[model samples]
Target: MASFQKDFKIWVMDHLPGSALLSEPLSLEPIAGDAGFRSYFRLNTQIPLLAVYSPPQEENNLAFVRVSHHFSSGKIKVPKIFAVNFEKGFMLLQDFGTELLQPLLNLDTLPQYYDLAEELLLDLQLLHPGDSIFPNYGKPQLIAELQLFQKWFVDKLLMLDLSQRDLSILDDLFELLIGNAMEQPIVIVHRDYHSRNLIVHNNQIGVIDYQDAVVGPITYDLVSLLKDCYLSWPEEIVRQRALSYKSRAVSKGLMREIKDQKFMKWFDWMGLQRHIKVMGIFARLSIRDNKESYLSELPRVVNYVLSTTFNYSELKPFNQWFSERICVCLPRYPWYSGD
Candidate 1:
């Protein structure tokens, strides 16, 4: 409270001069953050505003500014930036209130909300990505992310000392996943377009935490949505919804005419790559950052990885290794029963 009060007051005086907040008492309430270094505070004033304190060393404030502007120009419903202090890593943004789409989701509301999210994603894919300054999600980046599983989850978390043969198997799996990703159509991917990052403002979907957007596979964001790490939908339903998206993509001419089997191969492999990366990320969040709550979601993500891998003959060897060595060593939590 002491440190925040000093910085918040200075930010108000410096950025919000002559505003209504300066003339009255202001109250700031801490808002729950995600698995990141950023902190959010809601300012209880007439003007709906949010104060973000994201340390520049850990978070990219400039990327947020640039991407927010880029998305806004494309008519995407991202939070409006009011003020930014790059050096101090503070940003005052238009508050979207407390209504996140995660808690509101269920069997009844999932269809409606997911439809809206899908529509928004299509709109994103249609944009001329050449105008933006996002990174390419290429083979090297994809493999690096997968290796986080070895660095954080397998070694640090599970204490697994992988043998040379085990490492070779993983290398082959990574290549297959990377090849699948590079073969797809590229678009602006909102790398983390899950339930938690989406806001339901005025009955419309509002996007947040999009600084990591990239030019990647068309199926990347869809996998993040339908097969989200935070929540799981029935496989049949997920496939139906994914096929609906395929139809939409075909209509938009974003995807070429491919059979359902091949398209699903792309989707499943893309999701495998993501779930593998999330495993390492969640473990790192728990061990390094002391955010152990993410540990609970590890089983679900692992199940997603195993479920897909077991279905493919090429992935059978890696699946056998994970089932025999890794899966058995996983801590027995409530989600451990998933795989």
Candidate 2:
């Protein structure tokens, strides 16, 4: 009897021309939602479809539809939008089934799955829009994301008191991260291209949660997939896969042949930025949105940032601060793991 749900159902019903298939009294079972305010429900129609309620004020209903059309035409596997009402923030899309790409990932299955993922990613990057609607991932956006880490994770979550020197150090690191992102070969980036956001249906990897896609550094999406926030992989295996994608990108003329170390630096730095942003985002989700489960995943993100910082000399200052300030205090939390 909720207003939005009732209005959404009415809109979805109008879009489906075959009203004769109304034997089933419209039942809308809840589907798992993401970090956004969007809600999804599985419709019991003869052909399974999803009814989504993405709030117009909070979510970009128009952008999702536009990106979906753009990506579908670009040969990427994405949900086919059946009908949409932007004003009401309602959409009926092809149901990609219950199988998520997350649970199916493992060492034995990773090579094959990652290959598929990388292939789709390459297809996505091949799209170079001349006057596209997708925004550029410029310094302003990157800086805003980095500030979330400092504001939420460092200040609110950890209750850390940063002196003038500490604040200056963070400001310097943010600038470096922003520069790292801006200097790469620009391409379409699915900002959250990870296992959880991907769908496995009919033995194919279908992309989802790509509404936030933007034109950014080529290494952005690759790092998002390889150094996933939810899971960890051996360094050697992750490196091998990362390099393999670089090779493929070169072969496809997405980028010219580059040194493995150079590509690795971009990939690593990009991940560091993303994980740093996530620290702030995860904290915001916990404190502002009341999603406490997000805090459990911070340990994996910490491991990723530390792994690269310890290897690279430029990040030494950050490594020292994280080790002395952040890492030392993490052990007190139940989810903290040094390993």
How much lDDT does candidate 2 score? 0.88
- Tell me how far the alpha carbon of residue 297 in candidate 1 is from the true structure, in angstroms, after superposition: 0.7
C-alpha RMSD for every candidate:
2.0, 1.8
Screening candidate 2 with a backbone cut-off below 3 angstroms (N, C-alpha, C), the clashing residue pairs are none
Q: 183-260, model 1: which lDDT tens digit per residue? A: 999999999999999999999999999998889999999999999998898899999999989999998899888999
Give per-residue CA lDDT, model 2, range 1-339, as digits (tens). Answer: 488668877888888746326676887889889999999999888877889988899998888888888888887889988888888788888888888788999999998888888888998999865366698899999999999998999899989998898888788888878888887888998999999988887777899998889999999999999999999899999899999899989999988888999899989999999999999999999999999889999999999989988999989898898899899988887756524
Spell out the clash pairs found in candidate 1. none
> How well does candidate 2 score on lDDT at residue 82?
86
* Each model's lDDT: 0.88, 0.88
Can you tell me which runs of candidate 2 are displaced by over 4 Å?
A: 17-22, 337-339
Q: Residue 188 lDDT in model 1? A: 93
lDDT of 1: 0.88
